[model samples]
Target: MTDYPVSNAAQAASSAYRLASLDQEFLLGDSTRGVRFQLEYQKAQEALRAYGVVSMLVVFGSARVRENGAGRQAFWYAEARAFGRIASLEGGALGGPPYANVVATGGGPGTMEAANRGAHEAGAPTIGFNITLPREQEPNPYTTPALTFRFHYFAMRKMHFAMHAKALVVFPGGFGTFDELFELLTLSQTGKTPRIPIVLVDQDYWRKVIDWRALRENGMVSADDLGLVEFADDGADAWAILKRAGIDAAPTVNNFPLGGT
Candidate 1:
């Protein structure tokens, strides 16, 4: 094998001469969008698997919430933080061969940061699925460095959320939060995913935002479908609701992975 530097600059500099695997421009081009999506999925999926995250207790809430803001913001942050600690400690995230019910969040500020901080304080590794955004988003410091992930596609991000979740806890949020919550609900309704306990914090807030009875009244969802939702006053209440709903049942489904659904 005669390994020598290329003598021809033109040939070495040509785009066609570049190896496909090393061609960053080509790989990032629109033509390779599918590859990029797959790369995002695999990167996160493999990292989670390596860290033994068998199941997740996913938390959803508004990114705009603050620890010392007006009215309900502080309360929301406190509750979410409390819930993260409870889930991580009691849900089998600590000291496990294959950690289950690990606290997971969207990996940004507000509720996500609160939850991740709680888990970190409890000395449990947590997962955060961050996404690329127009306004920009950053992963919370509390998430385990190896488990923090970033994605370019919302569909893939949501898929990761649902695929590994053993249960879900939702706090007051606007459009993005609602979209994530309802998407999981739709998956449950359509039998696309295994049924998991879903608890909504602050019944007052949720009630004001959603007319649950109205949906049933409107024939949009059945009474049985209504059973899919449980309400809680705060983090402790949410944990209790999950316990009653049996969030700790089966613990090793491998999240079905990114490619599964």
Candidate 2:
């Protein structure tokens, strides 16, 4: 028998010849979109589990908020920071393993940073679920290094938000804040999610921003739909509302609605 070549050089150099797990080109291809989505969930879920985050107290607010400004700007920032600290201490984050109601934010500046900074000051671990934006959102320094995560897909990011959330506290924000708020409300109304206590900080701002009553009056939404939200005077009031709604008193339930499709 004639001796064969030790190996095919062309085959050895081919992308197809590489291991699937090691092939970035293959992993990032359009064909792997589902894989990417799954990986996004898995990576963050695994990291969170490793860090002992049992349930999340998600804070939503304006990225435009500032530490020191005129009137409500200053007020919102101070309250958000206070809420982060209060929830971290009262919600079982500092108690030890298998933490619950841990302070979590979008992992950017303004409200997110203020909240994270509070938890950091409280000596509690905080979470930052950051996303890639055209403007490039970066993680605030206050989130625990081990607990910080970045996501490529908003779907996956929102899934993470809904999956582990025990409660949601919304501060005054624009479009992005509204998007997160209504999605959770819709989910609550549809029973797609278990009861989520949605508290909007600064009652005056929220009422003017969203004419929710108009929706009910015009027969767009049910009269009961208006009851889905609770208003807070500030961060302390938010926490009290969450407690009465049984956010901490109730057992944490992770319901992946619609099978997380």
| lDDT against the true structure, each candidate | 0.90, 0.87
By lDDT, who's the top model here? Answer: 1
Q: Write the per-residue lDDT of candidate 1 for residues 1-261, one digit (tens) a residue.
A: 456675676877999899999999999999999999888888888888888888899999999999997999999999999999988888888887588899999999999999999999999999899999998998989999998888889999998898888889999999999999999999898888878889999999999999999999999999999999999999999999888877773468654433454
TM-scores for the candidates:
0.93, 0.92
Those runs of model 1 whose alpha carbons end farther than 4 Å from true positions after fitting are 1-7, 255-261
Worst 10 residues of 1 by lDDT: 249-258
lDDT of 1: 0.90
For candidate 2, the per-residue lDDT at 59 reads 94
Off by more than 4 A, model 2? 1-8, 249-253, 257-261
Q: What is the lDDT of residue 54 in candidate 1?
A: 87
lDDT of 2: 0.87
TM-score of 1: 0.93
The superposed Cα distance between candidate 1 and the true structure at residue 106, in angstroms, equals: 0.4
